[model samples]
Target: MLTIWSGLAVGAIYVLVAIGFNIMFVASDTFNFAQPQYLMLGTFVSYTIVVSLGLPLVVALVVGGVVGFAVGVLEDWIAIRPLSGTGVHGELVTTVGWSVIMQGCVLLLWGSAPHRVPGAGSDSVLTLLGGRLSVNDVVLIALAVGLSFGTHYWFTHSKLGIAGLAASEDRQAAMIRGINVNRLSTGACAVAGALLGSLGAVVGPKTFAVFTLGSILVLKAFVALAVGGFGSFKGALIGGFAVGVVEALVGRYLGTEFANLAVFGVLIGVLLLRPQGLFGQRRERVV
Candidate 1:
């Protein structure tokens, strides 16, 4: 039971990362590899505000969000916009390089040590249905799940969402129809940035603020994204929880070393069975 809760907590983080990837992908047909780093930056910023400056956590959230938004704008202007061309997905050279650069900057700014951030609500452990879980775990799980469904609903129902869908499918046609694709793209990045920034409050408590957090979380989130299917919010939820549970169960029964192995094993199995992922659209190319 404890293990399951642990998995859910960790998986919630993955879901957040996957959503960030999805937002960028939907907007620009590109995954900001630096997206994960953006969340990592949030954690450090929150840490600085909460610990170094002795400011309230709320202040940290707002500041981190602004910083993240600014960074997202810069990312679009510098790393993504300049290299716009055909076959860009397989060749996101600048974004990948930017991730490395962000990591280096983080190391220089925060050092290589991990810092603990305080959790909200309560510090006591609560037992639910024979499972022991922390307040932060419950908070993260509930928040991630709600956001996933909320996003799914919004994208499926709202006019703006429908427009985003149209834009994602065919930007040129959408532009011809007056969709303002560039604004959509920037808006997606900005929204994702704000979310990650606010999420740092809970995330820092669970994972600790560290320079390598982005790299680690991004890889696992990619696994979730692959398993759940690209462009599907429900997929992100299911895939994230699934990956987390599998990793936890494996670590508990097998060993810590085999946990990652088991998670990747699931990814391979899913792709082998359904290449487009469980919910992704099927595309056919003509030769």
Candidate 2:
């Protein structure tokens, strides 16, 4: 029971990250590898505002989101817009360069040491239906679920959402339809980065949230993306939760170290059987 609940919680986090990837992929048709750096920067920013500057948690959250928004928009302008699906190699290199820059900036600002967020509250465990959990963990899980639903609503119903979808499906058509593809891509990046940043700010203080940790989290998110299918929103959600459950069950019975290996092994198995993913559509290029 504990494993089940806890795994669901972790799965929620992965879902958030995977959706972030999907939003960027769909909007810009490019992978924003610097995304994890945004997460790290957001955490550090939250730490600065909340702990160092003595602001309220609400303020920290807002500030973190804003920082993410700014950075994401900047990256899209300076990096993504220029490349715009020239091919994966150029985008990958650009993203990697941005990642290095962000790492340097973080190191310079925060120094080499890892710092914990102040006042993460008592370690007293909360119980629900015989399942033990931490307050922070519960909050993180709830935020992830809320963001997931919110993203779905925004993408499917809103005006900007439709425009963004159009931009992804056909950039030239979107422009011809007066969709302002550049702005749409930037907006998607901002929203996705803000969500990931906020999630990091909320979760970072409770655990080890150094630069490397942020990088590792993003890698897990990518695995979730691959497992869920690259561009399928539904697949991202399902894959994240599925991976989370598997990890939890493995950790409970086997050990912690093997959890990741097991998750990837399962992902590989799935990909081997279903390359296009459970929800992914096979693309038909119109010549």
Candidate 3:
């Protein structure tokens, strides 16, 4: 039971991280490598607001989200937008550079130490269905599942979402149809950043706010994206949950090191078998 609940918690975090990656990458066709940094930034901001400045949790969360949103827009303008071309080379280089800069900034501000988040509702462990789990774990899992659908709806139903979808299919056609590609791209980035930052703010206190947090999370998210589909919402959710469950089960049976290796290997095999991903649309080749 403990294993099951714990596995669910782990899966939730992966889902959150992977969703952000899917949204940002699919909308703009650019890899926002700095996304993890934004997550860490959100965590750090919340830590500063709540722990250091003695602000309320609500306030800290708001500030953290706002900060993350701004960072996302800035990244799109500076690193991603500039590189909008035939391929993602420009965005890739710029994001790598931005990641370095953000890391450096984090180091300068927070140093190399890990910060803790204060307890939310309750830290008490609850037993359910013969399994012990913390309240935070329950909340995190619920949030992840809820947000998965929420984000899917946001992208598919909303006006902005339709515009984003149009842009994703073809930038030229989207533009010709009066879709503002730039705004859609920027909005997508902002949304991704806010979601990631909010996830960090909620999860960071429990996890640690460290320098390598961004890199590690981003790597995990990248794996999820590949496993799911680079641009598929359902793919990210499914891939992330599977990765988490596999990691947990593997770690329990084997060692932690083998878990990552096993998942990556599976990802490679899956991609080889189905390149379009589990639910991804088939890519049409241009002559």
Candidate 4:
């Protein structure tokens, strides 16, 4: 029972990261390898606001999100925009270079040590279904689930969200139809950054503000994305929880070392069996 709760808590973080991936992919059809840097920036920004300045948690989160949003826009402008339509696959390298650069900047600003950020909620533990969980855990889970579903609803119902989707599906067609693809792409990055920032604030208590947090979380989130089927929002939710639960159980029963093995084992198996992933469709190319 404790294991399940723990898995859910961690899984919530993965879900948030995966959603960030989904947003950028949907908008630009380009994976931002530097996406996880937003999470790292958020954690550090929140720590500066809430701990160094002694501000309220809400204010810290807002500031962190704004900073992240700005960085996202900057990323789109500097790293993504000029490379657009170049068909040179330079984005792959550029995004990775940007990620490395962010890491270096963070190390210089925050140092290599991890900093603790206090949780917003009560410290008391709650017993649910015979499982021990804290208020922070509950809040994290709720926020993650709410954001995931809320995003799905937004994409389904909102005009701008729908337009974003249309733009992703066919950028040329969307442009012909008077949709501003560039604006949508930038908006998508901003939204993703905001989400990651707020998520970093919420999960800081558990993971602490560390320069390396982004790398670890992003790797697992990518596993979730691959397992769930890229571009499928619902799949991200399911895959994240699934990876978390399976990892927890494996670690508990087998060993910590085996946990990663099992996770990657599942990934390899899935790829071999269904190359498109669980919810992904195989795209056919004409020769």
Q: Kindly report which residue stretches of model 2 are placed more than 4 angstroms away from their true locations once superposed.
A: 85-89, 118-124
By lDDT: ranked, best first: 1, 4, 3, 2
Clashing pairs in 4: none
Q: Count the backbone clashes (under 3 Å) in each candidate.
A: 0, 0, 0, 0
lDDT top scorer:
1
Return the TM-score for each candidate structure. 0.95, 0.91, 0.94, 0.95
For 1-287, candidate 3 gives per-residue lDDT tens digits of: 67777877877777788788778766766677787787788788878888899988888778878888998899889888876756546778888899899989999999999988764753788999999888878887888778878878877898877677778778888889998888878988898888777767677755778888878777777777777887777777787777777788888889988988878887888889987777677877689
Residues 1-287, candidate 4, lDDT per residue (tens digit)? 99999988888888888889988886677788888878888888888888899988898788878988888888888888788666685887888888888888999999999999887774779999999998988988887788778887888789998898888777788999999989988898888987787667778887888998888887889998899888778878888888888888899999989988988888889889987778876657478
lDDT of each: 0.85, 0.77, 0.79, 0.84
Over 6-118, each residue of candidate 2 has an lDDT whose tens digit, in order, gives 88777777777788888887666777777777777877887888878988877877888888898888888887778874544486778778878888888888887787875
lDDT of 4: 0.84
lDDT of 4 at 93: 82
Residue 123 accuracy (lDDT) in model 1 = 76
